[model samples]
Target: MAPMGIRLSPLGVAVFCLLGVGVFYHLYAGVISSRIATFRQKKTVDLRELLALSIEASVQGGREVKRIREDDSLQEKTKGKTKEGASEKLTLGDLNSHRKMFYLFKNTYPFLQVNSEEHDSSDGEATIWTPNIPVDVLNKVPASQMVPSESVTVWIDPLDATQEYTENLPKYVTTMVCVAVDGEPVIGVIHKPFTGHTAWGFVGQGANVAPRESYNANNPKVIVSRSHSGKVKAFVQQAFGNSTEIIPAGGAGYKVLALLDPSDDEKPDVYIHVTYIKKWDICAGNAILKALGGHMTTLKGEEIDYSGSEGNPGGLLASVGMDHKKLVSRLPPWDQNK
Candidate 1:
């Protein structure tokens, strides 16, 4: 006659509620983690494709030039425009690639609220940048330096080693990105599309090349730009002496990787470039090398300020597993006038 009812004791009810909450939390955490991983994987794929597209464009431009040279009629018709066309094609390809990557990052991480200020670009194109993720969110940077993520700047090198790419040295070309918080590199990503190899790192989190390989302390090998070795040659001789081997490499990013993963017969220990360089050219490599127990600074032993102008007039000196202070001490004082 009484209404059918089932009532559990307080203890039983509490146990049931606790179990439900635990299960829900587990599922939620799994989904969040999965989403983050998927986003990163997608970003890597997009970057690889961008690099491939840029390389293809460059190769095609070269072929077009060759065809023009081979055919007299074609050469005559394109006389004034041959050089211009090739340069424009490469430049346009790089610009388009940059735009694509910018959009991808913007769309994928909408929460970051990326925006481009007018001052960010001189060519009138939008300069894309996102509000920095908090230091705790990154969890890889020192809290003192990175807590105010608003000061962080994102540096992207759509295609590094432009000269190498034009010369058909695809292996040296790479797409690189770095996040610098308060003028210190906190994260970096470098992707070599030709080889389909990607390396990434964060400040305190170390790098993909954890437990970096050992190197010879006495004979420290140095890497310099293959195309611009003349200027560095004298400095290499002065700092490392005539005996220190100088390895000719194509891109800064590639050279940094070599410093981390040297050949069986050779062990690269330093990368020195004493000339005007752009922020994008070195940011990614700097971050990775720093994370891997190295240091990158100016010839005067000053750390780079990423937030300043794009041009790095101070020159760069990077060393792997070697005392950067000791290395700087070996070089003569830099003359700004020179």
Candidate 2:
């Protein structure tokens, strides 16, 4: 027993050393798993060809989105035909019209994934593209069946600016492809196909025009809806106070890009998804924002968790400036029913 109290024997010493190594390996394994988990959670989407096709179709089909937008009665008739009896709201119009266009474009442009179910209400629509995992299919697949833990995962907001598109505002509307590495965005491509212009951004990797600067500077620009409601306007006013400059952009994607390294020097410093900001509304933009060393958190400063739900909480708040604490602080509380 080697005096029982003091184990000086070689066997005892070896056992203790082995235990230490085991503990170290356990911790090391945990770290590796964390990195792996982060990587797997990263998300992205590719809309280059699809966007071009959409625009091309829009060139012929653009008249349709615009036609319905201008003729309220046409919209009402289209929605009334739906099983859900959608209202005249822009989002509903978008779903019904796009659903129609999908059928129209299917024979000619079969690549746009028109067969997927329409997951829109009076709020918005969520469609699936087959090339990338259909959201519905992704929901069914277990995490284990997904790519390796070190691989990246992305969610495509195929038609991000549905409202803008429905409103005949392709300038504000855009298509995006964003990729994230280890839960942080690294690559982003936002294309305003109508104008044949695109803005790209990167993190730890910089873009052509985006500077490593605060998100908000003088003349702080804001992208707002062309058809804003009084309630939303009042809320925005309260949040930013008077003398705030707002630049109207057609789509949420345009708004997000406007906040940071905007294609137009007149882009805004902040992007606010005040009401009904669905997951599709912010997914691609979130990928880009995070890529530029920026963040899109809830008003209370909590990191938003995507890949878990298609419905996002209320609206989102984001900025390229780290000093955007005021936004949350001055937030005008809202209701979910809206």
Candidate 3:
């Protein structure tokens, strides 16, 4: 009303300001969410590229080392004594040229801030860009139920099949795993260096390949680790009987992939491992298999808890399109304490 121009009361102006703030917040949140999704997708692709490059470099020729004992620094860091306090070892296999390739990839990305301590070779300048999105915001899981970031884990097996990789069997080698939140694997990425195939998924979000196979089977085709076959062979024989077709495979992730996408010659129905297997070996594969209507658990039928030390003391069993309880019943007695 002043000078015949539009005028607003103080309350009206306040209301307008609030509306403006609300719009900005909505827009900002959308942008952040988009960025996070893009970042994840990019990381998966980049990881596959790095693995491929490493494989090629190794083929060109490099010295191979084996059974190298962990130095004090590596042992202490792996034992959860460091500030990172993550109870998982970076690499389990012997230090070799392929493993060196892993270090090259890890140093190149450094997106995993948790591995900052291990990045001492990176000029002590690891860029830290930890995502702060609340769990409830990312998924349907409620924030109150979400585990703290410190407790939220990221399990990684940079080169899953070391024996296969060193032997020039690139088909069996893979760059495996990433991101488990609150002991539940939330994000997983598995890359086959030889095939240039990558499969990734997040919990609740269906995988690239949806579940379609039926679990009903008389004699299931089983996959056992080629390197660690003794215990698994016995367990498979006992659980599924000798009639079950046993196929020895290399990488844990590769075995899961075989179950996910079976070839004409080798159609895997179950993956059973009864010996000491690390968390990194299974987390990525577990996440993908779960997405494909499959289940992975301890032989005792308990869900594998990812919070503890790297070693899976109870052994691991994975089945595609089958009742977990029924599979558990078939197994011999399991003593987790052992």
lDDT of each: 0.62, 0.51, 0.59
Question: What is the C-alpha lDDT profile of model 2 across 1-338, one tens digit per residue?
Answer: 55656646898899999999999988798898878865654243233323333333323323444444456533422323211233323344345544543543344333222322133434322332333322322342223222232333233333445555655666675544444334444445565545655555444434433534555544355567554434456666777776777666666677777776534677567766555544445655665676566778765666665444545566667787655666677777776455
Give Cα distance to truth, residue 331, candidate 2, Å. Answer: 2.4
In terms of lDDT, model 1 sits at 0.62
- Could you report the Cα RMSD, in angstroms, for every candidate shown? 14.9, 16.7, 13.5
The digit string of per-residue lDDT tens for model 1 on 199-223 reads 7767666555642467655667788
**Angstrom error at residue 282, model 3:** 0.5
Candidate with the larger TM-score of 1 and 2 = 1
Tens digit of lDDT per residue, candidate 3, span 174-274? 66554565577656667765556667665665455544355435678888887557656777788778877889988887888887774536877778877
Off by over 4 Å in 1: 1-89, 108-149
Clash number for every model? 0, 7, 0
Order the numbered candidates by lDDT, best leading: 1, 3, 2
Q: Which of candidates 1 and 3 is the stronger one according to TM-score? A: 1
lDDT of 2: 0.51
Which 10 consecutive residues of model 2 have the lowest summed lDDT?
140-149
Q: How well does candidate 3 match the true structure in TM-score terms?
A: 0.61
TM-score of each: 0.63, 0.53, 0.61
Is candidate 1 or 3 superior in lDDT?
Answer: 1
